[model samples]
Target: MSGDNPVDRPNGDDDNERPEQSKGGDENNPFAAMFGGASTEQFAQMLQGFAQAMSSPSSGPVNWDLAKQTARQTVSAAGDSSVLDRDKRELADAIRLADHWLDDVSSLPAGCSKVEAWSKAEWVEATLPTWSRLCDPVVARMAEGMAAAIPEEMRQSAGPLLGMVRQMGGVMFGSQVGQAVGGLAGEVLGASDIGLPLASPGTAALLPANVRAFGGGLGLSEDDVRLYLALREAAHQRLFVHAPWLPARLLGAVEEYAKGIDVDTSRLESLVGQLDLTNPEALQNALSEGLFDGDEIANTPAQQAALRRLETLLALVEGWVDTVVTAATDGRMPSALSLAEAVRRRRATGGPAERTLATLVGLELRPRRMREAADLWKRLTDARGVEGRDALWAHPDLLPDADDLENPEPFITGASELAEFSDLSQLGWDTSDPPVEGTPDDNAPEANGPDSPGNDDAGPADGESPDGPDGPDGGEPGTDRP
Candidate 1:
């Protein structure tokens, strides 16, 4: 006992004993230099620290608390101003009005149940849950892959500490997510700006400060910008609300991609070899440097297919939102065209935060063929009218594919399967029934303004919004959101 503790060394090996390194050399044993040549003392100290960290392992795959905290801090540093009551009222009014106008151009009815103006920090909070859902699969897989990549000899050498590496992975992934989300908070105007439902199914939220920032260089009035963005938000909500299959389909694609993530054993080995675990911040920094960055991840065919599905879905969403918003705002808002062009440019170029998010997810959400998708939607609208175009969203199968984005005439005309349907009801779309209350009805007298009854003036009916506390799309018509 006074000499050296046998318990500290693996299998009570002598002090001079060394683990056999892989034939490829020390590079293969990433933890060799990482742990000072894998010394017993270093292992003991790291284990002590990991034990302390493990005491509170409630954070599942990602340390969501750290993510939220870091995101709030980043937004605060970037000057996140709390949204005022007036800001909320203005946005609520804009959303109501935008929804009213959308009725004429789109088949989906009023989708937003809860409308609020969010600060950048608030946006981060509201959207983090969805981000968690989207990121957890990939993050968990990455952790598993990395842990499995540990050399067999190193595994026996590191003992239980190797299993705890996943905890470190969580922290690192959380850090990256926090930074990426915080960045996106500054860039996104609403939960749906990136063409995915980042908030609750029926929740319509917008960052007013970001909206103003977006419209700044465009020389458009702040009100006009807000209304235009509001139209986009409402348009997105319509689909999110009416098309129950959408969120799952869109999110499922990401999960599918995650399932196909081909973790490079060599890369993980190299990464382990190079990581400076002495500094926790170094681990976080390394994640930002692209743990899954280009060429590092070899995309499998399944992954490519998932990406294509995701891309097509995203493009369809963006294109539909653009078409609906343009139709709703044109002639009504003098700056509609200008605003549309600005949005197109913003999406095409992307922002710093968008790029950061892309890096974190290993996927760029640029709807690469958004314009083409929009044209296809417009073509469908021309061929079958708004109801027909919207009907396609009733089922994922009905939506155009990547090929259709190129030459949509066949799909628009009678070449596709949709032509077989005499009416949308055959495809599950019920056109005969009148739209439910809160939904826009063409035959009904139009509300004079946003303040009119049944619009923003009335509060949630019976203490619940259409898609409120009961459930998403609870009171709405169509298949309930799953």
Candidate 2:
């Protein structure tokens, strides 16, 4: 038998057997021979052994590679294959035409007018940064809370194990967000479709095939539909690029709300104790329901307020987008309203997207106030010229509150007075109730209550609580608990 054939010899045969000089190699390691028969598996085992000896834990941080790969798989599952060359060219041409038309209507600078086509997967790659910025705060909180929940005794004793577990948590969250973002990519036709500047600034993007598919059942000519969508995309980029601070302000609101996510260590423990993490769907369900159960930990008023802010901000952004897109469309497509309604329904009834994001970090990345917001913006734009309307974005104080949407005209046109749309800062409400002398920072953990995790790092105060206070967080509960 050839020497390579290890099984040829009898079990006890020692003749012709040679002891490897390399003392520390796992015998079965595939890479043992590359380093003078040192098995990589053996090296890992030895390192693990050393860690065990030292009682040190290792490994944490997300596996971005795996997350991105899984996101691609999610996109594939969505099956958006409609972007052909002709469709892309037609979409680009339409964006150019729409930009020309919008120039006559408003003074917003033309943002990268070269329209690009993005496949659903491409969309994910492009927009994942925005998702990451919005998601990382909460995910970090969740992961750290998980890390902290381990008793100090166990953390010190099982350092390596703890580290490994934390790394696994990061990887797990990354996968979760990727899947959710991928699913969202299928639904969105452009950078700002969800009103969060999901893609890079200045680059107007569209999913031609998806747009065509979205408009297909409406029975609109593909050309007209493409043109209409292009206008929407152009309009979004114009507002986003021109109003430089708006994106950060809006994104900050989301981050602020997420900062309030107090990891219910109790719920997390229960989930970690039972769920099969290898099965991502099961893991997803556990993550979504865990942190989002705001009622369980509705311990603080700050959380409630943060939730409200996020909802209101979401409403304003979505409302503005809807108003502008509608104006740009000029009811150009016979099916414009139909398509809008379909989009609204799709957003209202989130499919896998809800599960995907919820699992990642317990944020339900949806605009619950889209319809109300849309109606408010439509009325406002009708009353105020687009420039007059866009002036609202000049400062967050000018945006409508959740209450304002209920009776928009008063806020929309009747009150040019800054007092109505303005906040405690500009409305002089700040002086009405200064923090009592010796009052601790409200951003600080309470003096007597259960501590708010990392309350110190709560993002900018001008957070977007969105319009509806009702979130997976208690009503108006922000995905806000960073």
What are the models' TM-scores? 0.75, 0.66
Please write out the lDDT profile of model 2 over residues 1-482, one tens digit for every residue.
Answer: 01111111133222213222221232322212211232233223323333222332222233445446657876786585746898677777888888887776654557653467988888877766566566666566667767656666766887777656665555554454454556566666677666667755567888876777677787668777777777777777766665555565556555555556666777656765666635545544454444434443323444445545554665666666677666666645466676667666555444333323323323343443456677876776677655556656554555676566556666666756433443323432211221233443232212111111322344433443533222334333112222
Per-residue alpha-carbon lDDT of candidate 1 for residues 61-96, written as tens digits (9 for 90 to 100): 776666676677668877888888999999999988
lDDT of 1 at 367: 33
- Give the true-structure RMSD of model 2: 18.9
TM-score of 1: 0.75
Evaluated with TM-score, which candidate comes out highest? 1
Query: After TM-score superposition, what is the CA distance of residue 239 in candidate 1 from its true location, in Å?
Result: 0.5
